[model samples]
Target: MSDSLCESVDSTNETPSKKTQLEDGSDSLSVIKKAVVVLTRLPEYKISALRPPTPQQFYSEDESHSSSDSDMEWEPEGDSGDSDFSVPDNKQKTGKPTQNDTTKTLPPQTSTNNDSVSEPAPIIISSAFAYCANEITKVRPNLPEEEVKVDMMVLARKRHMRWQRGKIVEIITREDGRLKYKVNFVEKGKSLVSGHHIAFDTTPKLEQLYVGARVVVNCQDETFRPAILAELPSRKNRLRFLVFLDDHIPVYVGLPFLHLVCRPLENVLDDVPDSPHKSFMSRYLRDWPNPHLTQYKAGYILNAELNGVQQRCEVQEVDSSLIHVVFKDNQHKEWIHRGSIRLEHMARFWELRRVQDVSD
Candidate 1:
C-alpha cells in the first residue's frame, strides 16, 4: 500500500506543469482587451489652445507683493553664538547656556582699589553739550584729566533714545558687577538706557534763569520761534516747553520731536526771576492776560505775528496765515502775515524756584 501511495504522489507532480502556462495566457488576453477599449474612446474633436492665467486676473495687488509659505526662502534669524545668549545693554537678560551658546570670558581684572572687590572703571560724562542716551561721545569739554569709564553700550551709542532729563526710577546691579539704572521720561515713559551720568547738584541748569530766560524751540531754518520751557526735562533727555502769545495762552510742546534751542545763554544771569511770582508776564503786565484765549480751534493753534518772521507751526488749518493773537502789552489784534508772529524770550518763563533758594 505504501509503494502505491508514493507512485500516485509522483504522478500528480509530473502532471501540474501546464496549469501555470494556462493562467499566463489568460492574463495576456485580458490586457489586450483593455488596450482595445481605451483606443476606441479617444475623442474625435480638436482641443482648445492652453495658456497660463494672467497675473492681473489671478492675483490681487497685496497678494502679489506678499509671499506664501511654499515660496518663502529660509535663513537663520541671527548668529548661533554669543549673539543668541547676549543680553540687551539697556536691560540685560541672559539665556541659559546651551552647547551652541558662544562662551566669552570677562576682561582681565584690574584692581582700582585696595579692596579685592572688582570695580569697573568710572565713566566721566562730559557736560559740555546737553546729553541724552544716544548722542555720540564728544570730547567732554573742561575735564581732561579724568578718564570716563563708559558702559560698552554707551561707547557703541547703540541705545538711541535721548532722555535729556531722564529721571532714574530704579537701580539694578548685574551679576557681572555692572550697574544699570531704569530711567523714565515725561514725554515717553520708561525706556532702555545706554548711557547715564550722576549730577552732583540736584538743581537743574535751567533753574538759574528764573523770570528772564528768553528761548525758542531750536527748530530748523532758525524759525526758532520762542517757546517757554514749561518744566525742566526729565532725568531722561526729554524737554517740554510752551508757546504763549499776548493773551498769555500756553501751548505745550514735547520732545525729542520738538528740538529746543540749547545754545549757551548769551547772558547766564538773564533767566533769573526778579519777583517771587512764577509767570514771566506777571512782572510787567498791570492786567493779567485773559486765560480764556488759551482755548484753541480743534485743529488750529492761535499764533501771533509781528513782522515777516515766521516760526514752525504744528497746526492743521493752513488756509490763512493770519490768526488773532494777544501781545505782551495785553493787546488783542489780528496780524495779516503769519510769519510776523514773534515769540518772546521771557526770563523765568514758568517761574520754577529751587527749594534751597526759597525765602520763608
Candidate 2:
C-alpha cells in the first residue's frame, strides 16, 4: 500500500493526467488518504497565540516615537486639553455647559489676568422736561373778532382736511353776522375759510424773558420753528423782538408769540418720583430732532404737509427745495416743500410704535 501511495504521489507531480485518473471514485478516495498520510508524516506542528506588530516594524525609531507622542496628545476639536477628563458637576447634572464655562471656552483668550475682569457700568440718565406733552389734550380756543384781521399769518383748514399756513387776504361779512377770511396759502394758492377753521400763529410768552433764551415760534406753515431770542423788545418796538430761527433767519416776533422752552433743574428732577414717563420725557427731550439738521433722502419715512394737512409719507425723490413723497394713507403722490416735512415727527411716530409693540 505504501509503494502504491508513493507511485500515485509521483504520478500526480509528473503528469497532468493524474486529475483524469482521480476522476474515478476509488482513485479520488486513495488520493485523499495519501494527502492525509503526507501531512501526518511531517514534523509535529504546534500553534502559538497570535501577536500584533510593533510600530518599529513599519516606521523608523524617530517616526515611531513621534507617532506614539501624537496619539497620546491628540484631542477632539473644542477640547480645553485640561488634565481632568471628568465632566463638571453642573454639566453632568444639566447636560449643558454653564454660562461661565461657555464664556471661557468660546471666546479667544485676550488677557492673562482673569481676576482683573469686571462687568460694564450701567448707564444713568437725567430727566429734563417738567411736563409730559404727550399726556396733554390741546383745545382750540375761540378767537375774538378783533384778533382775526387782514394780512395776518394764520393756519387754516382746507377742503383736504390739513391745516396750512396762509395770510388772510380779505375779510368778508356775512348776512348772518358770521365772518369768513380769504387766505393766500404759501404754496397752495388761495382759499376762503371761516374763523373756526383758522388757528392763530401765536405763542404765549414766559413771565420772565431774556436774550439768548431757547424758544419755539409758531411759523406761518403751522409748525414750530426753534429759535434763540436774539434781541429783547425795546421801548421803540415793544410788540416785537428780533430772534434767530433755527435756519439762521432773523425775524421780529411779537412778545405774545414767543414760547420759551422750560428745562427743569437737575436737583429738582432728582426730587421727583422715578417713573417710565419721566424717564421717557427726559430722554425724548434730550434727543429731540432738529429740523434744521434734517437731511432728506429717498426711502426716508417722514410726516409731510400735503394738500393742507400733515400725512405720513415716504420720500420718493429729493431736490434743492421740493421733496417728492407718496402719502401712506391714500398712496397719493405729491411734491411738497422741504420746510413742511418733519423728520422729528417721524422719529416720534416710530418711537411710539416701538413702545406700543413692546406693550402688546
Candidate 3:
C-alpha cells in the first residue's frame, strides 16, 4: 500500500507541472492579444498640431515688467555659520528663527550675554521701522585650526507691502552693535509715487549722523544682493540720501547734499472732529497711472460735497505729470494739479521723493 501511494504522489507532481506550464502560455497569449488590440486602435484620422503657450497667455502687461525689475540677486553673508533668510517684498510672515538669523553668528561669549540676566538692548526704532529680532551664534566650528566665530540676523521691524529694490529707504539703529544697521533704501532710478498709498507713521529714518552710522544696501547684479546697511565710516561717508516725491514730483538731491532738502518727517494724524472734515482719500482722483499721467491729463472725480448755496466736493485723481485734484462746486468739478494741493505730511511721500529730472 505504501509503494502504491508513493507512485501516486510522483504522478500527481507531473500533472501540477503541466498545469503551471499551461498557465504561463495562457498569460503570454493574453499579452499578445492586448498588444494587437492597442496597435489596431491607432488613429486613422489626422491629428491637429497643438501650439505651445506663450508668456502673453498668462502674464499681464504689468506683471511681465515687474518680474524683470529686480535684476539684482540677494545672498546673506550667512557663511558666518548663521542661518539667514529673506521674504519677498510681499511682506509675508515666516518662522522666528529666520527673523533672528542675524543674531546667531556672534561669538560664544557675546551670545552668552544674551542668555545672562541683563538689561534688554534698548532698541530705539523710528515710526517707519521697528526691531524684528536678533541672531546668536551656537556651536563652535569643527576645524583643525580652532577659531571662534558667530553670526546674527537683524530683521525689519517695520514691514511694507510694496518694498522693492533701488528705492532709497531708511531703517533706524535699535542699538549700538556690529552687523546691525537701520533700514535706509537708496532709490537709484526713478522715484515710486505708488508708495504714497502705503499708510505708515514715517517712510525713512531721520537721525543725526556722525562716525560709524550703519547703512546696508543691495549691490547691483550680485549673486545675493541681500539687505545690508553698514555704519557710515564718517560724516563724509554719510553722504548718501534717499528722496521720495509725492504725485510723481521730483527733487534734485543726493546724500552728499542732504541738508538742502527736508528730512523725512513722521506721519502723525492730527485730531479730526467727530462730525466730519475734508480728507484727501474722499476727494482723491487719478486719471491714468502716474507714469501714463502726463503734464495735462484729465483725471477721475471722487468725493462730492455741497455748501448752503455753493456746491463743493473734494476730487482725487492722477495722471503721469501730477496728481489731478478738483474742488467741485454746484457748477462742475474744477481741475487742480498735484503741485497745487498742499503737502499734508512728509510721511506720505517717503517713496515719492526723487532727484530732479535731468530728462527734458
TM-score of each: 0.18, 0.22, 0.16
Model 2, which residues run further than 4 Å from truth?
1-146, 204-360
80-112, model 3: which lDDT tens digit per residue? 111111212213232222221111111111112
By lDDT, the candidates rank as: 2, 1, 3
Task: Tell how far residue 57 is off in model 2, in angstroms.
Answer: 85
**Which scores greater on TM-score, model 2 or model 3?**
2
Model 1 segments beyond 4 Å from truth?
1-216, 222-227, 231-240, 244-252, 257-280, 283-360
* Model 3: CA > 4 A from native: 1-60, 64-303, 306-360
Candidate 3 — what's its lDDT?
0.23
Candidate 2: C-alpha lDDT: 0.43
Q: Which numbered prediction scores highest in TM-score against the true structure? A: 2
Better of 1 and 3 by TM-score: 1
lDDT by residue (1-360, candidate 1, tens digit) is: 231122112121222222223564563222211111112222223111123455433654322221210111122233422111111122223323322112222222354434344422111111111123222121112322222232311111112211233455656778987555555543455544422222111222332322223333323342223333322332211234333322233434443323222232444223333422224344222221111011111122222334433322222221111234443333534332122214211111112223325752
Q: Assess each prediction's global lDDT (C-alpha) against the native.
A: 0.28, 0.43, 0.23
Error (Å) of candidate 2 at residue 303 is 24
